[model samples]
Target: MESEMIVIHAENAPMPGISKPGPHQRYRHPVISVEKRRLGALHADEIRVQMIYAGLCGTDVHLMESDPQTGYIRSSAPANIPETGRVIGHEGIGKVLAVGKNVRHLSEGAVVTFESIIVCHYCDVCRKGQFNQCRNAKLLGLEKDGIFGKVVDVPAMLAHDVTPIIQTDQDLQAIACVEPAGVAYVACRNTRVTGGDVVVIFGGGPIGVFAAMLCKTIFGASSVSIVEPVSFRRSFAAQWADHVYDVEAFFANMPECIDVVIEASGDLQNINRIFRNVNANGRIALLARSGTSLVLDAMDHMITNAISIIGSRGHLCGAFNDIISLYKQGRLPLHQVVTHILDGTDGFMRLVGAIDSVLYENCKVLIRFASANGRS
Candidate 1:
């Protein structure tokens, strides 16, 4: 019974907009369980994966209780749930218990993780190696079943062998965080950030905090300044930035010019602030995923100072390797950034609640999951 695996199902889940209060216990109420099996060839090109830890994302929160059904779930799932089961969660790290016959780049017992966006090779973007921007992208947990399940069958192409990453296997769940860090890595690379550049970072969330940390560590910026109103996240920024302040203080202290601005909070209002705070010629690297309509002043933003804002997508290929190298080389101190770790049982709900608390409190949190099966 120790290795027993099971599949839990959700027949009906209300739209995130309609779900009251939170995401964990709502939307038909998801359940976590286990079953015992050979764990091979569960689906075509699907290799069974034993999930160790999966982080609950802010997007999951928006899908859980926020208004307007947008994001991954709204894009893939039926607005109403008389339709089919909904499996949610994308930032998951686990071990492969077995592999399908056709599987390559991975094998049974390999530790692995992957991005959620699955692109059809036939798409024009995929054909051009811009799969991240593919029009036909199908998100994993959003479009189909996600990695929240104890044992999942993942496409081999997406699952990179992460076993070599475990410097010490004792802390398996901490390694799961590589996915979010990978996100930060990809965002920072969008522009040429280097030493002596004055930068402003908005949205003291995990992404924003990492952006500040990376800008400090990798780029050696002359002065990395972060603008966030939250206390906890502001502290995270404090550890890295030469100057960290609330929105008001950030404006009061800054000149009318910054070299680069990284915005992690999805609030459209932040855009106006970035435009106001940065120098005439500057770069704006945005990591936020926005949904609501945003109004822009074309003349002020585009024509005058000639500012450039680049929208950051998910990880690029080789990004995970780059993040790992940073960690190994002591460039990124990922351990200090982890503020909270919750269990897999109620991880999603708990994490969503924490994110909301941090929005007000200003800190970062991650979910950590481990098996009852003793470490091998």
Candidate 2:
């Protein structure tokens, strides 16, 4: 049986009064209508992706609940997307089904992936190689149409060469997590963590686990400690970290302080406690999403201890290469971090509406979609 066609909004396009779309909008924004309108028209750079797998991200949940009243609008759309409605799936990986004119990088069956941060190349930030912060950044799945559907046309430039890293269609599918993993990879890289050290990490979410895992695989930290209150998440995160304890337990743990602190959890209280555990002259990279707020004793910490805090937004898809290298070397265990695989529609909706603790006990949850031409 064929599924109903869906009509989705282009990226960054707010529905009149709504500043941002939420889970309700998923039911409201019909991708079927858009497909019906251009039933047969060729999308210029469209290479209908058979969404093998896409990971569930925290930002996706926030966007699902976003209140338009409180949401802020950007000044312009991304440059690469001359057209306004770009599909947003920064964590998407799939096979290229059909290609438009002049698109040479991909082929019909090549398994590929990319980060969803599509930027307006003309923006100053983009010109400075900071495309993630481009004045006109239209993130995949955030600003435009996302990869939750069976068929989505992504901007050509936004797509990366995933041929070498993605081996099987299944592996290509799990690569959806590559985007956020790239985030952890980039955050750690920015810290330039090379020497042996002890690391403290906050949050036990997927990103938190990835951060801890890399601390083991990439930096080979002597001791890794994670601060998390959730029992399941803590137990799950403990598999990777040397010691996983309650967030409140931080005051008691005695390790003489850590060399680095990676704050993956967006909770302000966790952020505050993380500062207390970091050794003077240590580095802390903040990798939470937008709208997360924290009031820290900067003068006390910075002046007294000389701590360096680096704020990172949007992972450079470049980390996909690094993640790929780690996977090939058999250094990182991606299977532990990835969980649940659902058919696109159900998975997409469940992630939006019913993501409670019990649901996300698994490390990663992925969604699979059909080919653009409506073929599996």
- CA lDDT of each prediction against the hidden true structure: 0.64, 0.64
User: Model 2 scores what on Cα lDDT?
Assistant: 0.64
TM-score of candidate 1 relative to the true fold: 0.81
Give a tens-digit lDDT track for model 2, residues 1-376: 1222222342434456756643333222222122322325447776666666667676554433434563332212222222334343457776776777868887777766767776788977788887667787767765666665565666676677666765555555546677877788887876666658888877788888888888887877888888877787888888898899986676576477778878877666565655666778888888774444577765686668888888876766367778877776778767567666666565455544455633346666766665423355
Q: How many clashing residue pairs appear in each of the predictions shown?
A: 11, 23
Give a tens-digit lDDT track for model 1, residues 230-253: 777777668888888888886666
Cα lDDT for residue 55, model 2? 71
User: Candidate 1, which segments miss by more than 4 Å at Cα?
Assistant: 1-41, 68-82, 169-171, 298-301, 347-355, 358-364, 371-376
Q: Residue 292 in model 2: shift from native, Å?
A: 4.2
